[model samples]
Target: MNQRLNRTAVVKRAAELADEIGFEQLTFTRLGRALGIAPPGVYRHVSDLDDLRRAISHNSARNVAVVLSSACAGLSGHQALSALAQALRDWAAMHPAQYAALQIAPDPNDTEGQEAAHELISVFASTLRSYQLEGNDLIDAIRLIRSTLHGFITLELSEGFKLERPIDLTFERIIIALDAMLRGWAV
Candidate 1:
């Protein structure tokens, strides 16, 4: 019970630290200091840094799932995809550190973490299913949409599109491309 509670507290603090400092800088020692606990104390809760990272990944996945699911409600196909895309970008913008934490791949053995990731992906995949997509075609569309969104958002967050054109225009263009892709999706 004590370890579980400590793990919970540490995960919560790590999340806040990620929000404040950034996921890239989040470390066990930093997390310990943030919680006013010794570094070793954290080990009683988390096995090591990787464990802490997993916790953060799991936490952010759940958070993103909530955001995506809420945006996907009452929408379908391209409409749903647009809502999901905007929500993802907004969430990443609002929670850069947590968002970065979520970018890490969850361990295949960690079913809970994988499930959390799946929840978010399913929100996107389910939208495609509305168009009666199946097998490789459906998977391909999901990959296309996800990769497109992820690449664009990741670049935007890194300020890659710092040219004269407004980023919003570029984002709008992406939406158009996604819509066109959906229109041409194999049945």
Candidate 2:
């Protein structure tokens, strides 16, 4: 039993530690020490750092999907999109490390990885469906929304938005523009 350790426990602790420090700064040695185990002992729970990252990303995506879906509950169209966007932004602000971990692209061959990706996509699809977007239009809508929001988030987190404009206002304006695009995107 490794004295009370399990894959879930290891991953949970590792993710918390990653948030405490930074994602890239996380290491098996540090995770093991945090979990009160030896470096090699971590191998029992995770294959390697990438494996651990993939696990974290999977869990993070699932968590965000739940959050976004809950935010959109009983809402539709722009209301749902706004809630989803704000929830994502707030979640990222709170869990910067886990949010960053969620950015790791899933390996196509990995079922677990792909499932996690689908978990997030399904949330987007549900919201987009309210707009009656189908086929490539729906896919492209999701992509445009993701690309714009992800870009803004990545820049904000990295302090790349050094400017005179307030980010909060900027994000609000971005959402308005995005919603406008979504409303007219089908045409």
In order of appearance, the predictions have TM-scores of 0.91, 0.94
**18-124 in candidate 1: lDDT tens per residue?**
88887878887897787777777888888988888888888889988888889989898778878888999999888888888887888789997899888877887
Candidate 1, which segments miss by more than 4 Å at Cα?
1-5
User: Pairs clashing in candidate 2?
Assistant: none
Model 1 TM: 0.91
Q: Which sections of candidate 2 miss by over 4 Å?
A: none
* Per-residue lDDT over 1-187 for candidate 2, one digit per residue giving the tens place of the 0 to 100 score: 4699999999989889998899999999899899888889999989999999999999999989999999999898888888888899889878889999988999899899899999999999998777889989999999998988889888887889988989999998998898888888856
Residue 115, model 1: lDDT of: 91
Error of 2 at 172 (Å): 0.9
lDDT of 2: 0.90
